[model samples]
Target: MLKLMSLEIRKHKLTGLIKGVLIANLIILGFMVLVLFVDQNEQVSTFTSFGDVFEGLFVFVKAVFIIFASALLGRLVIEEYRSNTISLLFMYPIPRKKLLTAKLIIVFLFTFCTIIISDLVLGALLFWINHFLQIIPGQLTWILVKDELVKLGTGALYAAGIGLIPLYFGMRKKSISATIISSVVLVTLISGGFDQARLGNFAAISISLGLIGIAIAYVSIRKIETDDIT
Candidate 1:
């Protein structure tokens, strides 16, 4: 199963997709930073702090991620069922839960890793620009780097939490198209709540909720049998 999974990944070139996403995110961040730099003044409005800048970028990028992922996963499930390849998936001796579990793991892990990589690139660019502009005049310190790393990692995890719903969609219904559409609608309606993630205690609550999303997806996947996959 693992080997087949690897083949599945290779066939799809999921890594390439992640790389494309990272590059796209970097491009978007670059444009945003350019705009902000042009608009900067002695009295910086909302964009005063490094945290605010980063958070603003995150909110924008994650909105794209959330919308695209929901539709992508929804379509992923829908296509599998529509194409009837799910029938082949059940041919192996593996339990249906294990198969679904593998797919869920692959999907969310890919989502999380891609997001983290994008943030890391964004952080690096931010620090470079700050240093170049002499905005943060000081020696390069490890603590600052560590803080950025933490934010990147934690922020990615939080984003992934919201994205895991795509896995649930794929698990419960094989129509990727429908799942993606529904996921997009849901994200649009609920994004306002998570948009406050930069505020106090929101990160912790978000991370906790992300774990819950994973748990729910696992439970949903476990309830079905191999035959039902068809």
Candidate 2:
């Protein structure tokens, strides 16, 4: 599995995916900075805890990660089918199920790790900015860190897990545009509804989506078993 994942990583090294992720992170940082300039009378000005700040930032984080996952799915899965390169992959000695599993794992790990690290860095920077600029009126504390850390961990997994939904659609339709579009729609609907409906908790929403993604992944794996690679 590790070897297969390594092969997957090498396949994408020259595809500009890494560069795109970096650029996205920079954009996220800029968004965080803009939050600093929110008017004093704005709703954002009322945040008084690191938890609130993290939640606010996560809205953007979730959107960004969802888009990132879509791109990865398009490149890794849909492109293979469109270009007829997945047939070549099927020629390998590995079972079709194992091969597909490896690809899914790569997407999950890459998306999960990137979001966690980016969120941590963004959180730290927000804390620093708030400490000096008093933009959000929050003080960073060890307890706050501990609390947010748990949320960050779960959120990262949730983001990664949700990518499998697009993976399923991409594999089933073999359409790159379809995969990306589905992700965008899913993110907008889930995030927007969760916020407007005053859902139980973001974590619960993430978990629910994660479970759905897992189910889709399972169906995808079963699919490739009978799917024609040609």
Candidate 3:
């Protein structure tokens, strides 16, 4: 699986996606900082506590990466099927299911690792900025750190699974636009709310949605051999 994933990465030149990820992180961080700075000058509390900051950061990170993962699915899976290049891949000595699973695994791990890393990095940068600028109130404590570590782990897992959800839509029609658009709608449904009352904040909702994505992947892999690549 690892060898196949590596081959897929090399064949697709996916290392280039790192630049896109970095740029996305920078944009998210900049927007966050700008919001805080503006709120500080207005004497308006944008985030009342460090927990709020963490939640806000995680929401942004998860939203971005979920969409990003859908794009990856489009490139690695749907595009191949759409272009009929997947027929060529089907001719390989590899088991069809194994090949498809490798692609899904790569997308999952990429989304998972990137979301966690980007959130941590951006959180640290925000803390450093707050230390000097005093943009947000309250002190960071060990308790907060411990709690957030748990949240971060669970949140990333949920997000990684949710990221795979778009594959179901894309595969239905072999349409990249459908994949990306479905992701956007999913993000809005999960992340949109007044004052941090997002659907994603609910553990039950996140878990259920994540499981749906995993199920989608499982079904896709199980049916790969019988699927008509033509």
Candidate 4:
């Protein structure tokens, strides 16, 4: 499992996805910082713990990540399915279960790790800017840091979690475009109703749903009859 994951991570670099996540956080944080900094509104916070800023940032990226995850996993599946690659792999006397497990673990952890890195960078950058002008008081303001981190972490996981659903769809469709669009539509419906409200317990539910989706995908892939194997 470790070797398989290491191989995929090395190939993809995961940096591109991390960059996407960071850019999204900053762009949205920019507007919020502007509003608070310019207007001097103490009540108006820069952190979008649950509102549109939180959810909105993922609006486009949500689907994009889904496609990425799907591609990350599906590419191998497709390779095995369409190109007769699985035979070489299967003939090695390696258990097919191990192969499937490795792929699923890599796909799941890759998404989680990307989110962790991106959120850490984003939270650091925004807090730096906020503290520079005393907007966020000082570096020792652990409360602000903690709050923001919690929100960002939660938001990120929620996204990465639900984001995997698209991979399943992508695997089914095997079409990049379809996976992308479908991912967007799914996120819209999931995160739509709780808009402008604190994610609260629903965030937990989202995480659960994400894990469930991943589990189902893993099992499905265990029996997946792809002819190619990357």
lDDT of each: 0.63, 0.78, 0.93, 0.57
* Superior by lDDT: candidate 3 or candidate 4: 3
The backbone clash count of each candidate, in order, is: 13, 0, 0, 7
After the best TM-score superposition of candidate 1, give how far the Cα of residue 189 lies from its true spot, in angstroms: 5.3
Tell me model 3's lDDT, rounded to 2 decimals: 0.93
- Which sequence of candidate numbers ranks them by lDDT, best first? 3, 2, 1, 4
Which pairs, if any, clash in model 4? Answer: 79-228, 80-227, 80-228, 80-229, 81-226, 81-227, 81-228
For candidate 1, give the lDDT of residue 162: 70
Model 2: per-residue Cα lDDT at residue 21: 75
What TM-score number comes out for model 4? 0.65
Instruction: Give the total clashing residue pairs for model 2.
Output: 0
TM-score of decoy 1: 0.76
* Of 2 and 3, the candidate ranking higher by lDDT: 3
Q: Per-residue alpha-carbon lDDT of model 4 for 24-136, expressed as tens digits?
A: 55665675467546545655544333233323334333444544566665555444544556576677666766766676666666566666564555445555675566554
For model 2 the local lDDT of residue 151 reads 76
Q: Give the per-residue lDDT of model 2 (tens digit) for 1-230.
A: 88888888788672567777778888988877775566455864535556767877776787788878888888887888888988999988889888888888878887788788888888788777777777766466788889878877887788788877887677667888889989998887666654336331555777898888888888888888888766
Q: Per-residue lDDT tens digits of candidate 1, residues 122-206? A: 7678777887685532355577567767876776676676776666655555666556765566555545544354332366656
The best candidate by lDDT is 3
